[model samples]
Target chain A: MQKSRDYAEWYSRYIDDELSAEEKQAFLKYLDENPQEKAIVQRLQSLQQNLAQLPPTDTSEGFETVLRTRIQIEKKIGYGAIHTFFQRWRMPFLGFATALVVFLVFSGLKGIRWDGMPTDETAVNHASMQNSLSLPASNINYTLDQFIASPSYSTDAASIHYQPAEDETMNKNQGVVVDSTGKIKQETTKTIPENLQLSY
Target chain B: MEGREEQSKGKKPSDEELIARFQQGDIYAFDLIVKRYKQQLLNFVFRFLNNRELAEDVVQETFLRVYRKRHAYKQVAKFSTWIYTIAGNLSRTELRRRKRRKLFSLSDIGMEEKDYEIASDEFNPEKYTNTVMHEKIIQREINKLSSKFREVILLRDVQGLAYEEIAEIVNVPLGTVKSRVNRARLRLQEQLKKSL
Candidate 1:
């Protein structure tokens, strides 16, 4: 029992030299009784001795100076850069701007019409005339009634049939008579051949 | 009256206090902490890595981490334990990195032998050859140790940290720390005995 307690106490005190005298005596007696335990203690003591003999590592000279400089630089740069970058642009604003730019880019790629394309007013007027000519005489009455209701349509019936061509000769040669309903009616003169078909 | 006496005695401010002051912009206090622990930290790293320059870098990195994390420090454990934990983590990372780089690069295969030769050449010629040889043997034995056991032995035997402190640093139980240290010391002694 004494030997067991002695060994346990020695094991605890082996880490530091705070062992009391009685504890040391008891441990010695325990070691004498237990050869295996004695061997273990000896090994531990040698290990301690070797650890103590280890040379002190040197860390002087420019090491501290360099370390301090690095730390200061890291602190200054790390916090400030993140803060400055994030502070300048809120995430939502940046995301919105990015989305807008991407949308413009893709839309441009797909050839969305811009406001600057030339308008063919003459072509549009010709297309409208063609559409009116293609309609049946009954639909023409309804369309005419709607067009007259609009303030932009003129009230003169003769003016509606007479669209002045750019060339005066072409208009006379064509001599195409269009009714109020915009159906082109050919008028035959005795001088002109009956089989002659004129088309505009 | 007791408080006044305690103040009059002026017990050194604990590591946590010093760290708090450091976080509050007391650079001198930090400097004192560094001065106090740099050698031990360097020694710990040097033994673990077996490379002086790498050890120095690890020590610097450890201190930098500690300083950066100063604000998060609680006084739950000793400051030494915290600092050691940082060192251990950094050293382990460095070791892993080195292993990975070595596996990929394969350029420095013979560098350790060359370094050993260089180290031997730099030693004193006349008086301390045996001591130097003994140190080299010990260094080789330490290198042979598994990293976990090596760390335990280093923390306990070389650094003189308590088992509890080591447990905190290693994030293990006190019993584990003691057992690991004991096993590592035994292994080291066995190796030394065989060499002798």
Candidate 2:
């Protein structure tokens, strides 16, 4: 009933049952004296009663079972380990390892040039050209220019010219090349004739 | 058997003892802790969120957080204080997330009346008959209170926490908790009177 100026303190003490016998008596006397405050107190009592009457919440059914299962499953999945490790070290470790890897790989590959490697198509074409250019022993003296210029040379003939350079001769006096040393030479060139035209 | 009786009588384990046992992977000790406070925790969280499933989720998350952070727990504060702090933080976070997600439409909350009716029916048949009307009034009034006042009321009246514990749980001064609870109770009374 708010007889005292400190209604909040009185209410709090009343709820906790901390008021002394004399204080509670005085408070009840005050409530009896004030009609509006008595009404308010009545309302508060009703509210408390209603709150008390509210059903007790049922949390027992399968709650602990579910919790135990969850906790077990969580433990199986490294419960706090993953979370704790990540919280403490993930960012720094990830950053350090990533930087270390980048540094090591870059340092090791410093002189390597990936762009310089021949493409697959070019390597395959080159290997095929080398195979097709295999010539007979009788035609070994014919220069690649003469062979390419020959009237019999057709589209069916592989467009590769194999030449033995002069310095590559087995017998300098004979000016002839021999396979005794198994020596071979190769050159590749792509050309467009003057009469050919291209559209962009 | 004597010690087990004392333990069952709720002679709370010392923080160091609990911590040591938990560190040794004694989940039953953790279970004891959970058993001691789970209902109160559920009530606190349920009042905050007003949804049972969400409240249960918050409780689970709170315990999980506590378990994860158990190693960091210091004895400077009471274990209940630390646990409630975790629960309060998680509840606040979930509330904020719910706000951001905009998932709590008025229509969604309206559906709760039906659920409450269904839930209350299982408790007591006679009480359930009058529960709907009274519950609606109480729920509406409680919902009208500011979050601060609502929290104090729920903690003090519903959860039956002491003023000091409420202060620790809400992370406010003890005086503030007392004043808030008183004011909230007064406001609820006023609202109830009006509804009558």
Candidate 3:
């Protein structure tokens, strides 16, 4: 006689016809010797038959049409969701993105240094220009008047000579021509001939 | 439809062949596949969930998944196994959702009590009513089984699938599938005996 556990294993296989010829013969012998196992098998078989005979469940009417409509609606909703999302935020997002790109490009061109160092040689030149404008040393032996009378200043002033042209209309008075405000004219204006007047 | 019939006349294509045709852009082949398996899948899922609406939804989702993922169906596996796997996965997801809802809703407790009241309220407390009532008892017992045993048993007896196909659908070894089916049957039988 077979144990209930072993019979449990063989019962499904026997019903399914999966047992080999030798196994089937041995299972039959086991069932014959064990009335309890035979009764169990009989009960299982009856249960299987009852289950198989249960009322068939037909699908509802228009099932395929409903499924097709659902699929169509789903596909549309999927595509429409993406389209609506882009439509809603496209301008703002594009504007923000464009501003960001522009800001990045210009900032790259301006080259903001993040490492606490100067970005260009112009900073060094600025420092030197600032240094040149500082007050002279207090220990200097010369006053402001003496510094103004220095040879370098005198020569620099003399190099800039003002030569007046031959004035056709005012050639009669050439000695320190002064009329308005009694001030000596540095450069007298030359009168151009009527035929030589250039159109500016 | 006529074009499809004429294209593959006088011989019905296998599930794999239909699937292959679907992958190659034959829309009618997909229709054929859906028609072939819709009722079977509906019955399987209905038994698993014990709810008609939910079963229909699962089967519909299963076909939609099959349509969307037709290209993923390789020729190495049987089409029935692949489609059954999809249906089973959807059913499991539904079950998990139900479990979550039951956990969160106090009303579900009341609903369960009502269910018991309904089950207990037969024509007479002393006698079995009709075949329908008996089938209800059987269904309740089947549902009472743990999901693993319930799944293997339903796939075996109710769906009438081979052990090998069940193994493929459940993604387990053939031996494991066989053992589970046997154990499920034995457990179901014991439950029925106790109820009797």
List the RMSD of every prediction in angstroms.
16.8, 15.1, 20.1
Full ranking by lDDT: 3, 1, 2
> What's the CA error at residue B93 for candidate 2, in Å?
1.8
Docking class of 2: acceptable
Per-residue lDDT of model 3, residues B119-163, tens digit only = 445534233222232666667778878888888888888888888
The worst-scoring run of ten residues by lDDT in candidate 3 chain B lies at B124-133
Q: Residues A1-200, candidate 1: write the lDDT tens digits.
A: 36454355356365456468887786777788888777667766766767867887998589899988997788778965776678787787789999999998776555444553323332233334454445552343112222223323223232243232333222223333335554434331112123322232
Which residue pairs come into collision in candidate 3?
none
Residue B31 displacement in candidate 3 (angstroms): 2.0
Interface RMSD, candidates in the order listed: 4.3, 4.0, 3.9
lDDT of 3 by residue, A67-168 (tens): 888778878789457767998999999999999999976665565465544444334223322332232323112112212223121121132112223342
Chain A (alone) TM-scores for all candidate structures? 0.33, 0.39, 0.37
Give each model's whole-structure lDDT: 0.68, 0.64, 0.70
**Model 3 lDDT, residue A141, Cα:** 20
lDDT at position A107, candidate 2: 47
Order of models, best DockQ first? 1, 2, 3
Can you give the lDDT of residue B39 in candidate 3?
A: 92
Task: Predict model 2's lDDT versus the native.
Answer: 0.64
Candidate 1 Cα outliers beyond 4 Å, as residue runs: A1-37, A79-200, B1-12, B113-133
Encode model 1's per-residue lDDT on B68-179: one tens digit a residue. Answer: 7787678787889889999999999999998788788878897766654434454453422233335776777787799999998888888888888899988989878776
- Candidate 3 residue spans exceeding 4 A from truth: A78-200, B1-3, B7-10, B110-133
